[model samples]
Target chain A: MSLFHPTGPRVGSLLSGSIRQAAMTVARRDHGTPSESDGAPASTVVEARTSGPSAAPSLGPSFRSSEVIRVEHLAVSYRRSDGAEVRAVEDVSFSVREGEFVTLIGPSGCGKTSLLRVMGGLLRPAAGQVYVNDVLVKGPMPDAIAYVFQDFALFPWRTARANVEIALQLKRVPRGERRRRALDALDMVGLAEVADRFPRELSGGMQQRLAVARALVSNCGILLLDEPFGALDEQTRLVLGVQLSQLLESAGRTIVFVTHSLQEAVFLSDRILVLSHQPCRIKKTVEVPLPRPRGPDQVKSPAGQRIEAELFQLLYRESLV
Target chain B: MRIRPASLAEAYVEVGPVRRAPWWSPAGGRARLRGALRGRRLRVFLLRWATVLALIGVYEAITRLFFAGSLFLPPASEIFTRGMGVFVEEGVPEALQTTAVEYGIAFAVATLIGLSCGAALGAIPGARGVGRDLLQVLMALPQIAIYPIIILFFGIGPGAKIVFGVTHGVFPIMLSTMSGVGEVEETLPRAIRAMGGGWVAVTWRAVLPSALPSVLTGLRVGAKTCLLGVLLAELLSSVNGTGALVMMYSANGRIPQLYALTLGICVGAFAVNTLMTVVERRLTRWRG
Candidate 1:
């Protein structure tokens, strides 16, 4: 990679210090190649290439560039209640490939949630730009993206199916079709039987599932999840981690997951972007070359464990910052 | 004899190593407890009425024995001696008729104005802070002390009485609405906005339903106060309403009919309060 020669120098890139130098230091990750990081001890990329063609859903001309989302040196800051300026996200740059399940992992209060909010156009970045589906995102585009919140955020007045229906309702889908699609999404999440149940009536795990179903009910190509399983127990988390991976896989959707759990990131993600503390920055990106149908054993394998440990070390050091 | 078997859920219980508390007793035991409760319910009902009857009896006996001839305190028997007679002979109905009509109009209009103003203040943060200070100040001020001026401006008629009633009744509704709108969760608005909802949708779908229970409570408070305010204004001027006749009867020391008329107005006010309370409870049934 050339040290200086490049396309028009983006002002946001200067704030991150460098673009060309940073690109060269990182491996070839612009495309969904996710090149497998060979067994080089302490190599920054603790990952392997994704199973390319199997993950590809469309053969259309639009599939030429696999990048579905690009965060161009984003910086987000806001004023605190004490009237002090707090920088939430600082010069965080990364790209998510189409049909990829990428996880943003960091310690608590590290701005992973802020970054996720920025991606969904819920919060504006102070500097830089976020491009989703090749268009600059200025505000919430329900048709382009769907968000699943940690608290479930399900409408208590609405039934499980009606909650899901709202995703389509917002898109202006006809009532009949919205209902049909809602039921189908519920079935995909194994919640079809409880379609009429109110969100308050459901258990913690079920409520989260209903939220997931709501996200799916929308035809949005990208799903943004912020700690969707953070409130669940160990047993439910493990089960959901596997089930969610399969659900997203079959649906051929791109998902950006925000989480604090290193193990969860390793288990579900095609690539894991470890974020640093407070004013969050991308610390490392790990690729899991582990084969499909990842069982508990696969997640607990030596390779997975090594990548998880590396992420933990980066997180621990960044937590102090 | 047993009426039925324990439910399927109840049948699965394993015996505890130690005897459990009666509070943790089986569903079968609950049925027996419920049956016993039914018997006690009737007795409780009788006992409640008995308590009221005993109080009235005691009051009548005490007044009859001590100071029976005093013009101030009247015996219960004497109070009801002209119970039906007061309605026809003393013009009690006309007084109550005027008060009821004025109270109804004042309460209804006050509620409409109060809810709208309160909702506006609550939905907007800047308005809420200012409204909170101003509303509390107005509600705290003794409106009774200012009734004379209200009558001087509007005159001693139903018009003045209604204006007083409305002024008194409007605050609770406004206060309740402010708090109710505040209680609506922030998440609902974001969700609606994300789904392409406009301001109208957010106000109607999220703000209104969320604030409903408290608004109903405010309305109930408004209704009770409206009646009191109208009566108070009437009492100040012996021109119209039950307030006017009550003043007239008391000045003449007609204690029995005065007591009876007072009792009727009190009962009517209580009935209105009960009705509003029932409506509020029904509207808030969705609350867990």
Candidate 2:
């Protein structure tokens, strides 16, 4: 089973092996022509195998055509106070296709964030490598990847518009273009009215929206969201999730979203990757059979309920261990 | 699933926008009257003025009644009447000019040194530990004890006085600036880096602005200390300046004129402090 070819028939064969060796074989085989496996007909095979009895429908030919990001046998660990190494994420390998929304879900402290950080080049992996557009990610590629942190790490001093403009300013975009694009991004998040207000002056939901605006203003092809709506209340989370779905659907950008909410995972993702408890590894991969541009209606649908129920069972089982 | 209120109107009656109460209404008139007299700034201002006027009245009453003929305690009225004599006195205006020049130069130099040294200590991890300890020790030392050393190095001219003022003023500014820079959150720098901001941009956009409020506070405290240092140095060794004039008036037993000169200096210090406070508040408006 090759991890790089996500929709291949060989997915169920490999488990708990040395991924480094497997990665080399897979990388060498699929490195040059990554999208060869994602042909139009292969998506139905994906739906039948992963979605099972509640299979909805695929996005058809034009969607998820090529590979934009590849992670090969990635592992993340950090040193403890006594100098012992504690592995957080182990043997995690996945690929995000162009314009696909993939969610990583697991119990708390499962190192889902570490995997995302490794992909963003904010945290270095102990093993394996991440590639964006076939270029190895050694450090933050601000031009190619924009990250929305869980904590809404906005500059307290700058106004909302200025905060969004910072992304373009870093790339040395001219002043006029920067202003136009920053306002446009703010408008997309329904925050154009409060564009001149400071982050602290905004409510929690608005602040997260401001963070999304900042990420969007960069015009990057890929976005890495780390529990962006984690701190909000239930209603706000649903609203934001719906807004995010609409926004991403239009933009056709690749996204790797990390979250803890089962309903959120089922509602917003094209595919959900469930991870095991500690020393995180892929526990199960569920293809969302729900339709795109998701809203509250999707979560109430029968397919959404089945996916959510499966995810809850997987997480509940892991918690007992 | 539980049923929600089909309409909020089912739980409570929905009302249209209420009309405003007329000014003649009893409750409205009473509320307006209370509002006119109830405000934080107004209360504070009235209290402050009352305290000053009461103290002046007490001084006037005590000196005129209890110390009627004493040379040491002149009446408040006599001092006010003789205050104009301070400017008219020979060499008095020249002495004031000298003090102003020394204070101005010392303040400018201290600000320059304090900002640069503070920024260096704040920005560099290597310097922070040792530099902070050294600053702490210097700040705690009684600056007057070092006056003789300053005189020995710079001589008993305006140079010595200015140097003394700098020593007294520099510590507060430096310490505040250092702490301001140090207290900037680690997330801010990381956020800037993630945006592709280099070292200069991070310092300019994140570090400096975050530290500004603390730096302004230090400046306010430094202004008062510098003024004190200049006056103390003048009183200790100089032959001319406002400090020397105080010495001469007291020596000649001109008590009312001496009181008048002291009052003038106090007024000037008060004005400078008030001005600094306003500036600090103006710049850190975002804190609100």
Candidate 3:
């Protein structure tokens, strides 16, 4: 749809052959895709992926033209009020190519969110640095990144449309223009009708969708989703997962998602970065050979199962369970 | 005695047969009455008026029958009619004007200082603990005990009343605001920062809006306390203002006139509280 049309240099290549192929798949179905058909098998395939590896050689060089986010030996630590020190992320290094979907999946409280925060410049890393579009990430770079928090950090006092308009307002967009853009963003999320409804009035799934709309309206090249669907039920998660994949297909923005759901990782990611328990480190980077604008049946397919099994085994081993 | 079943269907029934009522029946009428009262706004209005009229009726009855010549408890009708004469009494209007000015200035000053100080204390980590402790200490003090000190500093004029009012009013607002600002979720400010908002934007957009309910609660409490402080100052000084008028009436044993003046004060307090409530509802309409 034109709603996802290129608004900046980042999305300029959205209509290119590869991305169009994905957009076509999205266009073939309505917003509520029939994801229920494969729900059972799709869920069972969670967390299985290829053997331990940094990156698949075959997929390299094809999309390495631009590295939008680079995390170099990034380490994060927190200090307690009682003067105790606790390490969260340790020596984590990775790079995300433009328009790639990278999923950070790990056990609960394993610092995936901490790593995402560091990349978004919401938190200052104790060691190393993050670079977004070649700019050092010492602090928030709203121009380059938009973050969707796990709890759907919506402003309770503002309606859905107003919440979406906040980032634009911060950027000093004209009132009339921001209004239009906000409505358009809400429409894209199928929430145009409830644009005037406060966050508290929305359902859990709708709230998450509204949060996504807010992030989208920012029009940032890099989207950071910290377990955006973690609070949702499994059924809603699957549906939203499918819808998000389609939306990202058309938007063509690089995404760094954090989640604990194996099925979600398998369904939405181009690469799954399995993280170890606290003092988080990248345990393995599994590349999904599955094509973009993934079909509903893909998660239940043999290849998807193979990848999920590998991921599950890796995490199972990492957890020492 | 032995009884036989009327019919097979009746025998199979678990309980006695149901008796349906017609529209004119008492049961049906009562049900309809309940349905009518279910209209929320109408019911609330009726209930409120009923309570007020009942209280006034009882007070009038008791005073007229039992305390017919009582100087301390005059009839409600006299308070409304003869008591209202206090409005036109000499110096009463001037005292009202003085009180109004004092209230307006004190409330405005308290609101501004309370909000700013509260936001600062709440937002600044280093200041939060110390600010909280200081506010607690101030809140704990018997504000009335300082009336003499205020009188000495500002004299018996409106200055003393305003200052006293502010002292009485500012603590609730500051404390409420501090807690309100402090209670704002960490994610909100983080969202603003991620959107490239600096300290100013975070405070204005995130901190202020999020802390508003608490700040408003503080303001409401402060407003009431401030009014009390000013009135008490005037009453104690007994030199000028509405409090002085009240003191004069009571000292002279103008029982009806005193009650009338007291009733007027009650109305004024009610009006102020009502105005605050309306404003609070209007601003927080988004909360719905």
User: Best DockQ goes to which candidate?
Assistant: 3
DockQ of each candidate relative to the true complex: 0.12, 0.19, 0.25
In terms of lDDT, which candidate is stronger, 1 or 3?
Answer: 3
Tens-place lDDT digits, model 1, residues B170-281 = 9998999998997799877777776666778778777787889889988888888888789889899748788999898888877778888889898999899999888877
The regions of model 2 sitting more than 4 angstroms off are: A1-65, A79-85, B1-43, B126-130
Q: Judged by lDDT, which candidate is best?
A: 3
Residue pairs with backbone overlap in model 1: A36-A48, A47-A287
- Predictions: Cα RMSD each: 13.0, 11.6, 11.8
Ranked candidates, highest lDDT first: 3, 2, 1
Kindly list the per-residue Cα lDDT of model 2 for residues A223-293, writing each as its tens digit.
99999998888766765675576455444467899999998888788888999988999998888866443
Tens digits of per-residue lDDT, candidate 2, B1-288, equal: 111111233112112123345558998777656765797756877899999999999999999899999889998889989755887888988898899899989999999999999988988877888888999999888888989988999988899899988988899999889889988888777778777788998899889999999999999999999999999998998888899889888899988889999998998899989999999998886675
lDDT of 3 by residue, A1-321 (tens): 223322312212322324444444334323423321221222111111111123445236664556788899999999878989999999999998766789999988889999999999889999999988888998988878999998988999998899999999999999998998888777777677667777776677678888998898877878999999889877667656766876775566789999988888988888899999989999999888775446556677898899999999998988884
- Write the number of the candidate with greater TM-score, choosing between 2 and 3: 3
Q: What's model 3's TM-score? A: 0.85
Give me the chain B TM-score of candidate 3: 0.84
Displacement of residue B267 (Cα, Å) in model 1 is 2.6
For model 3, residues B89-207, the per-residue Cα lDDT tens digits are 88888888889898999999988889888887887888888999998998898888888888888988889999998998999999999999988999999999988999899988999
Candidate 2, DockQ score (0 to 1): 0.19
What TM-score results for chain B in every one of the models? Answer: 0.84, 0.85, 0.84
For each candidate, the alpha-carbon lDDT, in order, equals 0.75, 0.78, 0.79
